[model samples]
Target: MTRMFRDPVFGLDADVVRRSVENVAPPGAATDIVDLFARAAWSGIAEPGDSTAGFLVSAVGASAALAMLVERWSADRIVRESMVDVDTAAFATQLDRALVRWLPRLDSRSTVRQLTLAATCRAVLVTPEHPSWPERLDDLGPHAPLALWLRGRTDALRDTAHSVALVGARAATGYGEHVAMEAGSGLADRGFVIVSGAAYGIDGMAHRAALASQSTTVAFLAGGVDRPYPSGHSNLIGRIIDTGAVVSEVPCGGAPSKWRFLQRNRLIAAVGDATIVLEAGWRSGSLNTAGHAAALGRPLGAVPGPITSAASAGCHRLIREYGAVCVTTVDEMAELAGMSPGETNEDAAARSSEETRVLDALSVRSPRSPGDIATRSGLPVGTVQSVLGLLELGDLVAEKPEGWVFVPQRP
Candidate 1:
């Protein structure tokens, strides 16, 4: 049953809620107040990359989906009402799993409260229906954001035709920061928007250089646009909001967790035409962004530092092992942005087939045995054994007491 509440308790009749957020709704959108309210609610309820919320909003309207959850509808009822069916029972499996996750977050009061807070912060909501929503985000397909909570000029997101993502180690060396600055200003002067997560080290340097070049830049955050994370970058983030944009998939007040930071990487890779790893240690989170770009089949580039620098070890791993093109100058990066394709067929022709798969199975955060890696990579244990031997010899991988781990080359 469809229902509307006009309770004297919160006294939030639909019109009253609509009037409160009227200014930030995307101009010319249908803007039924409930839809605006639901998007805000969904941002808070689901963590970034929540497929169930993404799919539901894409299928049913955001308003109806939010209403179903707010009413505490059953999983079966949700599937029946929203039509989230798929072949061979996949839809049933997805919906069943989703119910377990979504049930705990069904409070409508929290949604209303978050919306009220966002209004006070002057944050804006941009759904796919908005004129400013970047179409490149649709490349994520079902994984596209439900809505983006933004604190800067929404118009800056309108054209991402010339955007490049510059990411690297948070604890960057002076060499890394210098390269990032040069790449940022050079790319910006050549007419590209600089995009990076607003972390310290390389990301901060990139944004600053883009600003110095007088170019539009954007920060894709792991937390709420309203929250300045690293708390150190508060001033830099404010500068971005004034000049470019700060965007997030999470609503106002959401905290940046480790998992959210990992999830936020995909957005950075997807929005930019190409991604540059100015520097990263072997286990640097920046590699996560490079992995996403490679998975999306977008061009990826890495800068080379002296062999002595541990900070650039990840870049070496990407180039020598995973086939990332070595980009020494902004012109090469421009080529990646579309003047030329990244690595040539010859570079690909040179890779040992097992190298990429074995590397993929290994994680920077944990260790895995050769047998376990075979399972993740779907290769025979014998083949994994041979590749691990080769990788170990190259110092691309290390053996720990627990198992083998991907690590930086020790000086």
Candidate 2:
């Protein structure tokens, strides 16, 4: 049955009681409050609570008499014993002056064909009330968003419950971007949904790799999903929405804000089963996401990089100080996602002898220069260089100030 209550802020009879109950209840939690009412009018900007009619006159002026009365009656009790009345029209007019303010401007147009397309693709929005909504996110406590707007197959959210957020700096080094790609592709191939911000650098690489590998990926936006903030990654955002989802709690037209970005990190951390810092600097926002992941008691991992590089500072910090595990391969990420590594069989042995020879020539100690490696490995310099480039791209071998170092990460 639709009922009405004296809205403390708006004055006209509004469904404030139901809305308040929905806001306070944990995601998916329901209450049987037959008579939920506003015994106390929420006052103050930062923290609004309850109030009595007598208190309203003094605290909110005589105009708020009805609101204050409703609040006082609505207190601790589930429903009020009796309804108090006053002039709501006058109170609403007064509140309008205090509450009316302009929202920030939004971008003229965003390249979010993905979001619109998702809706067209029959993707559904899963608010807190949805049975499929993740309860673990409640670990965020009050910081959790009121709702999680999903725009892909809802099954992905439920089935990929073991997702891990892979995030890092936008100004990523080649090493960071490569690792992100491998991890993203590897994890996705294993059926894990890759979650990221859809920003450039590590985020873009991760999403692209997953799509390239035909895997699902979700992007959590700081602003409206329609407005891919960076603008440089419109293509990636579009692809993600094509196969996965782009979600945000801010209204559809809300502009991005620094505070909103910080807040958005918490969602990425809470929604996933774990988090991996692919690449980040000393003060990168990825570190903030890691903090949220750790605070929620989720397993955190970091891909270590060259000690000399500033881009890996955040990852190193997590591993050394914040207790994040060090991971090097997608198999490890799959394990973290609660899945077994994929099997490699005899078909892998169908490789040409030249390819195997080239793989063997790359090493850490006594690392051969490309020219020398070509001669030692008894192959064309072009072939050796090509193979070495692949190795370098994989982060298996890195060139240091001293020389090339062969780093064999976990299988």
- Winning candidate number (lDDT): 1
Q: How many clashing pairs per prediction, in order?
A: 0, 10
In order of appearance, the predictions have TM-scores of: 0.78, 0.58
Model 2 scores a C-alpha lDDT of 0.60
**Residue range 359-410, candidate 1, lDDT tens digits:** 6567644789888999977899999989888878866678888888765322
| lDDT for residue 103 in candidate 2, whole number 0-100 | 10
Q: By summed lDDT, which 10 consecutive residues of candidate 1 come out lowest? A: 339-348
Q: Would you list the clashing residue pairs of candidate 1?
A: none
The CA lDDT of each predicted structure is 0.80, 0.60
